[model samples]
Target: MVVTTELVGLIHMTTRPFHNLLLPRIAVLLVLGALPSCAEPAAPVHGGAGTSPTQKSRPPEKRPDSSYRPPRGFTELQSVAGRVARASGHKIVWRLQPGANPGPLVRIRGTVNDCTIFVHPLAARKVPPNTWAFLFGHEFAHLTENLGTHSATSPENELQADITGARYAMAAGYRIEAFLGWVLTEPDQKSDSHGSLHQRVRAIARKFGVPWRTIERESKRAASYRAGR
Candidate 1:
């Protein structure tokens, strides 16, 4: 069939085998059909949302990190990201890559040539799909900001991304305290990378107004900020 040859050729472009690529045209069409066409989907909250939610109403609660598995409802994450990208007048590509951060904080690492917003396929698939979406947004913030810069030397750029990501995550109904609990606990750094954990968490906390107590506790500066308050 005319369609068959074209489909086969396209499949051949994949690293998979010929037999693997040889699927019924209907099956291929169905698979492609299900995916949303988001050519230039709307940008997400590029310029910040209207107002911040007060953390005063809630008790001092500790939210455990969300499951880090392959995403079950990842499409929603993509749609949300698309909106942010559109709003920001930017774009992002989500992919499952090797060497995802083995820790809780959603990792966002990329370079100039072949950048991708990584989503732990297995982690994203588990419960608390919102966690994965938050990570996706976090990475996008990095990508979009980095797009405006030439090198990755700016720690402010990264912190800005963290703030951007936190805003989206908070707006998306993810517990900022919970998310930051996992993030601030992280105790490693690339020598060439940004500042200490205290700096990063504070940067994100300020953006979402996640409460001064929360940051103080995470940074182990609780007594310091608390005494002043």
Candidate 2:
């Protein structure tokens, strides 16, 4: 009888805590259910290490500007353009257009279409020697991928050409300053056919190891000039 009573007592002791826990839970559920129907729903809990569920994440920052500098060897214009073209495994036929209207004058310096390159002699004579060479290099770069004018207006293609052309110009021994004079003096806005002067200048500056400050200085100078005029 004592053993039976002891076993019964142990069973009661073991179930006491379980019964206590269940009663509170049931009471809580009943209290929640009895609350006013108009009560606001509980806020949802999120499970992340950092950042709130309602907050939007910020976009990534743009890449920092970089600089490059090339060694000297800049000489003949055709030779440099040839080197750039050859580097891309292409051979070009150079053509000189007669009049300004049908030449580079009508279309801003030079162009490479298919296997041929066209430039106006009159237009060539107007810019600094290094810039002239750079122009040739730029056009040659367009022909490098054998894409020609088909990708002319594409920003990606145009940027690639500018970067490649700048490198070619550097290889040909032209300093970044050579093109900066013309670039700063005549900043072209973004167009359907080309990038903004800002984009071009930044690309050239990045490729040739020129400082962004130089462009800033030139822009300020140009702005001042315009203001003065």
Candidate 3:
């Protein structure tokens, strides 16, 4: 998912400053429109022809932010982002925000050369490492491919991200099934900008050559594991 600083206006219009109280100064551009909620996955598109090839390049050095103290387990998340970024041949600046209900994993493009991803603390703690690869991989696709910049709607943008992200994560050595399982957990709602969960599942399944039954099995296993925990 992607968002821009215009969210400030949205906050004011809704009189709901609490939702984005800690939003950074960075200006984020969302080609896929405003996301409904953190749990909601971004939109979709068909075909794999437009996917960008991964170029070999050095990962960008971390920019120092004295006010930013790395949260516990942040290093691990950074590692996941690094793996995805390397596989996509894009430099990403990863950041964690302090909040119980912060936004989804979103990519912020301050400029053509600057791309950053921000996630909630809860997401970092609750989502497993393999799933993180999928999440970051999704945002990495948006950043590298410059998706939604043209006439694509939210569903088109999100579907494209799903396909590209799965490829990048797979290239980075993460299981594609993990992403399908994660998608199964999302609410199956079809919105103006995003597709229903089932639609996304089918799209991703077709793209990765994975069976829908396999994804369903993984989802059940994940649920059982969580229940046991």
With a 3 Å backbone cut-off (N, CA, C), the pairs that clash in candidate 2 are 67-209, 68-208, 68-209, 74-172, 74-173
TM-score of structure candidate 1 = 0.45
Backbone clashes under 3 angstroms, per model: 22, 5, 7
Off by over 4 Å in 2: 1-90, 93-99, 106-114, 148-152, 215-229
lDDT of 2: 0.44
Model 3: per-residue lDDT, tens digit, 43-64? 2211235533331232222321
Q: How many residue-pair clashes does candidate 2 contain?
A: 5
Tens digit of per-residue lDDT, candidate 2, span 34-110 = 42221344223223356563433433222111111111122233454565555444555544233332223212223
Residues 93-159, candidate 1: write the lDDT tens digits. 4443432433222344443223544443323332244344445555666655542232334566556
- Residue 32 CA displacement from its true place in model 3, Å: 40
Query: Judged by lDDT, which candidate is best?
Result: 3
Q: How do all the candidates rank in terms of lDDT, highest first?
A: 3, 2, 1
2 versus 3: better lDDT goes to: 3
Off by over 4 Å in 1: 1-115, 125-128, 147-151, 188-190, 215-229
